[model samples]
Target: MKYKNPVISGFHPDPSICKVGENFFLVTSSFEYFPGIPIFQSKNLVNWEQIGHVLTREAQLPLKREHSFIPSQGIFAPTIRYHKGRFYVITTNITIRKTFYVWAEHPEGPWSDPIFIDGFRGYDPSLFFDDNDKVYITGASFPGAGPEGIFQAELDIDSGKMISESQFVWEGTGGSSPEGPHLYKINDWYYLLVAEGGTEYGHMVTIARSRKPYGPFESNPHNPILSNRSTKLPIQATGHADLIQASDGTWWAVFLGFRPVKSTKVHHLGRETNLAAVEWSEEGWPVIGENGRAKVEHDAKLLLVNEPTPWLERDDFNCESLATVWNFYRNPLESSWSLTEQQGFLTLYGQSCTLNDLESPTFVGRRQQHFNCEVSTLMEFSPTEEGEEAGLTVFMNENYHYDIAKMIQKGQTIILFRCRVGSLWKVVKEILYDEPSVVLKIKATDTSFTFSYATPTGEEKVIGSGETSLLSTQIAGGFTGLYFGLYATGNGKCSTAPAHFDYFQYVPGQE
Candidate 1:
């Protein structure tokens, strides 16, 4: 049996997994995107479903990143654990500089309000439950130590506060950025797994062990048991992993990795979740997928559990609320969008903001998982003001985005293609239109994206095409990937009406 490298695809990065009964639950980092920390559930490692988001409300994740953190600067990384009867998610809000913990009785939950882990500072927090029922939190930071390093502390789960002084535990395999630490007691020794070498080209997974939960940790002889930096593997930057024991007692790991565009170093879809098989050596060390290079396909069981389905690719705007897959850039204005107000349509009220502004503009998007795909939406928008515009976008961040909008010009509304890279903003193409309602579409490949709109006679004509590589992290310089969805804005002036989206669809191309 063979399974693909990225068992979970797209911008769902920084994966952390824990088992509960016969099910495996996982979570990933969601920087600056509201409804943060997506949660997934699986019966077998090969198939996963987005069960829900941990932070579902703006109050839970109040990202004031406009003046400080940008699109990819808010949430750092998260670690999930199952202990007692509750499931815990520990994460750091880089924008606010606070490490917090949230828990729920069920994986899909009304999770508890965050309790700041006071006195504990820094990022990539993880929880460890020892055999004695004691819990520990590990993070990449100094604990009043001689230098910045991975630290550990006993935690009171109920208060979400440290009960013991934090101590510097493992110094890593000397890889840069020693972070995303998780602790587990395998046999008689407790194992510490941490990702180092940063989160890019040199990213890797290293392990250390100690007799106790906190100290005398020795780095594994074969440190960095997983990584692709030294290989020609297409799955680059494979690290930040979490381990789980399946029902059959097979050990597996779930981590984040990116698949670059063919013949190019550019990967715009961002770091995605990849699954791998783990084998424990006789010396009590875990050896990862074939010399730390995972194959594109794998299967742990000769008997597969459930057949998998492609990620969500379409929405008819017929639901009561937004689907679990949709996300806003940051804190969207509370009253700006609705699904039920127009019945069978998603109405996005034009906000007084543009895509370039750090402020939250009216936008709702999904991750661009595949490079070659077709995304289209039927939008009925009548912009009454010059600055008001509504359409689709292949967005990276505020500074780097491309928009195909039906905007008000002079007094008439016209379909236009707006491209912005850093400080440059230009209208690449436009077509005069008497109708406000039009079907906007974007056909994208590894190299470029073609923006088009449907004519009155139902003919879809290309309005503009731009280099897709520009949105890559290598070019845009962000920790995020491509997000294609609907956008409506007024450029600081509010609109008189809302933009109505009847349906949205994305059809992935063949591999």
Candidate 2:
């Protein structure tokens, strides 16, 4: 028990929650991460456990190619719901534009392939079912000439088609940008809650209500039913919420929020999930936290998963599939990655001219959830000639990265730790690699990182160490977490130079 802010941590943005009996299921926008849209199961709305991912099969989504980096254009906000005996999820992949639907008899799904919702724009999509068995789907629109707010439309659940014309319900309060819509029926009114004011400093939650599913819904007299600032609190980015009811009949909201170490920067942890208690006033508007802005005591009874998950960095690469810790930067080709065939090693097939090039798209990485942790990998690479390189790196977007790599330059085997900080790639240090196989380790502590390397049978040596303070959100602005992964880039002339990773692990309190 003893739950505080962020029951779920690290890049878990735009949360959508649904209640099935006494259990609660939550999902979030996965962006370019592979096995998109992680589905989590919780009981008390606090501690959560990752049950599985909805977009596990590549055929579930239509990608531009077999292997590609979507670059901020993958799965966006997703809404999950249960109707009759089937569970349905409606969502959008910004790259795909069309809204899509998938369902299963059980939440842990053998989910049917996606059924595209013909026409829609903007990312966040929510599904609502009325007591009469009628269905409605709502979503936010990407910028265009039309009204920029949340839109709702009736849907035929069996066919995943919008029946009625979709329309905006509210223009949103001044200074707030409406997005991330969640619908619910409370008492005699239909409540529509959305995240507005962007996803940063001004982020907030707003609500509107109407007697019918689609209508001239009136704004809540006290809009922004729940937000960190409504309580004048310190947590930032208090938007993108999903609401559910507790077994005790108490209403609760689980939304994404972050507490930055400083106002100007964000640690690579991305957004952390926060919890709040909601209550309907006598007049019937929801009140958040304690008395409006009062600080509430930590509730221990809300813990969802009792067992703890072993940290990702500690995993021994001895599994058939990538660990829950690993996520591809974008959609991956199933043919390139393997764990079981390699026996004790995780093999990554080399692809692409550069990391951004779409063809050879295969990078297996893990989110940098902790600011200070150690990540290391053991691997080997065969460089056909100069310009071929494979190694382990701390990657932050396309513009920033640092790596400890092994390459054959002019037929001489060498190990180099280099960085592409800001604009240029600088070779910070270099050492002779007598063998093609080597081990690379990175220690990140308080924003500074150090790189070390070792021959397959030689002693380890510190190759390079530098300040990684710029690897923060303020410097490398994005709505994502820092990642560490195995990488290979060349002129695309080599047959195959695979990196065999004994394992990739993260350990805290290590030098």
Candidate 3:
């Protein structure tokens, strides 16, 4: 059985995992998406289902709806661990400059509110439970003094506080940015695994070992024991890894990597989740795959379920609340949208922020997981003011997104197509319409996004097409992937009008 790469797809990145009983649980970085820190459960490492989010309520998260977020801010990296019958997740919020942890009796749960670790600094936090039951926390950071390396301190899990002075453990294999530290006491040797080099082509996993928890450690002779940095494998930036041993005594590593668009080096889908098999060398070193490079296919015997879900592209909106797949840009103000009020439709009340504003602008979206795909939605909207409008968006971030909306231009209702990249903002296409409702569509082929609108008669025509490469991380300069979202805004002033979305559908394809 050959397990395919990207056991998890789309923008899910910075994966961390832990095992309990016969099950494995994982968590990933959310980075500005509300209901942050997606938690997943898997009986086998290959197939997973999102059980819930760690930060559900705003009181614990506090990413204000009206606030603007820069790229790669908000939630950074999360590490999950199960100890003494409790599940713990530790991570950082860059925008708030804080580190916190949440724990539950079970992997899926009504998790306890965040316990902020006072004076905890840096990012990519992890937890390690020693055999003696002494708990420790480590993170990537450069403090004011001492050599820069992974830092660690004894932690009081119950109080969410650091109990001991921090110390620098390992500097990694001298990679550009050594981060994502996970420590394990395996066979009496403390093994320290850290991802280094930047997160692109040079990303790699390096290891070190110390007899004591605090190390003047020895770097693995085969230093970067795992990486695809020098390979032609479809998975690139292979690092940021966590290890878990199964009840059967098998070892596996879960890491983050990206699947670039076919033949192109650019990837807009963002870093995704990948897995690899690990083996111990006679010298006690952990070797990844047969040749020390992450493999695209692993032995079928390792995974109980090797099937990955085909892209889920359609949502009916008839449910009482938004499904787990849909995510908001920031903390969504609960009063601005609803599903029960209209029944079978999502009504988004127009807010003051435009699509270009970092503040929440009555928008909700899902990841664009495929290069060749089509996303469309039926929207019923009536714009009474010039700046008031609502429709669909291909969003990368505040400054880099494409908007195809319905707006009022000089008292006439029309379909509008606008392009925004950095400081460039211009309406690329417009079409006048006599009707107040229309179905808007965006067909994303390998190279471009083709915008279209359909009439009541069910006929459709292309309104405009734009280069898809414009949304790539190389051009957009963000740590997030693309999201297809429904949006309504008044530019700056709030509008009373609402945009009713009949449904949103995404059809995956290839060319």
Candidate 1 lDDT tens digits, 159-263: 887999988888897888888899999888999999999889899999999998877999999888999897778889999999888777778888888888866
lDDT per residue for candidate 3 within 1-511, as digits (tens), equals 7787787788999999998887889999998898899999899998989988888887767765343445667788899998888899899887787899998997768889889998767789899999998999998884553566798999988897788999888888788888899999999999999999988989999999999999888999887887888778878889899988987788888999887766568888889988888899888889766566876777856567745766567887989878887888888877678898788889998788877776777899998877789999999888888778898999998888888999877889899899998889889989988687799999997678999999656799888878777888878886888899998887778878888898999998863
Task: Give the deviation of candidate 1 from the true structure as CA RMSD.
Answer: 1.7
Candidates' RMSD to native: 1.7, 3.1, 1.8
Q: What ranges in model 2 sit over 4 Å off?
A: 65-71, 229-234, 290-297, 301-307, 310-313, 358-360, 456-459, 466-469, 509-511
> By TM-score, how accurate is candidate 3?
0.96
Give candidate 1 regions above 4 Å deviation.
69-71, 142-146, 302-305, 310-312
TM-score of each: 0.97, 0.91, 0.96
Task: Note the residue pairs that clash in candidate 1.
Answer: 2-298, 3-297, 3-298
Model number with the top lDDT: 1
- CA displacement after TM-score superposition, residue 18 of candidate 2 (Å): 1.3
CA lDDT scores, all candidates in order = 0.86, 0.74, 0.85
